[model samples]
Target: MPHYYLHLYNDMIVADEEGLDFPDLAAARAGAIENIRGLICETVSKGCINFSHRIDIADASGEVLTSVSFGEAVRVDG
Candidate 1:
């Protein structure tokens, strides 16, 4: 299993000191998306959230694995 760090990025970098363990990049990515969803939900309850927020997932070596935008993680059905 490999370790991955999920950082929250918008206008600044919020690093994740403690990373998560995943079997592979695919699994890590899925986990990161779920994290983004959770943040989006929290923002929704807060009344105002910059939909431009994003999640930057990196490997243990600090290399970017993937990025997910807030708008893509959640959607309003209309």
Candidate 2:
């Protein structure tokens, strides 16, 4: 299993010091999306959502594998 770091990029850069083990990149990406959704839920009470928020998935060597935008994770209809 390889370790993947999901770093949050919102108003500030929240680094994931303690990385997680995932079988592959796809799983890591999914994990990032899930985390973003949870974060969004928590932020709902704040009365403002920043769609530009994103999570950058980085490898052990500090290379960013992919990024998941908060806007991409949820569908907003008004």
Candidate 3:
């Protein structure tokens, strides 16, 4: 199974969904990124910390797939 790494401030989140089949890789990747951003925003909000940090998510190969700045993420309007 393929694995993904979501890097956060003090912890790293990993998910193994390689064996799962998807219709589109782009959609799957984008969905994964969005999910991580939501998680980051939720964590920051609950901790009352500055949701102004950037999060970097990478693949198993250590390649950065996407970067989400805190400001852009915390915004209410999409």
Which candidate leads in TM-score?
Answer: 2
Candidate with the larger TM-score of 1 and 3? 1
* Candidate 1: Cα lDDT at 36: 81
In candidate 1, the residue pairs with backbone N, CA or C atoms under 3 Å apart (3 or more residues apart, or in different chains) clash, namely none
Scanning candidate 3 in windows of ten residues, the lowest lDDT window is 13-22
Candidate 3 stretches with Cα past 4 Å from truth are 10-47, 76-78
Tens digit of per-residue lDDT, candidate 1, span 1-78: 899998989658899999999999888878877988887777779687776888888999999978888777777688
Report clashes for each candidate as comma-separated counts. Answer: 0, 0, 1
| Model 3 pairs in collision | 2-18
lDDT of each: 0.84, 0.96, 0.53
Model 1 scores a TM of 0.84
Writing each residue's lDDT as its tens digit, candidate 3 over 11-58 gives 443444342333444544555557656777667667754454555556
How far residue 25's Cα lies from its native spot in candidate 3, in Å, is: 7.6
Ranked by lDDT, the better of candidates 2 and 3 is: 2
TM for candidate 2 is: 0.95
Tens digit per residue, CA lDDT, model 2, 1-78: 999999999989999999999999999999998999999999998988899999999999999999999999999989
> Rank order by lDDT, top first?
2, 1, 3
- Please give the lDDT score at residue 8 for candidate 1: 88
Which stretches of model 1 miss by more than 4 angstroms? none
Error of 2 at 21 (Å): 0.6
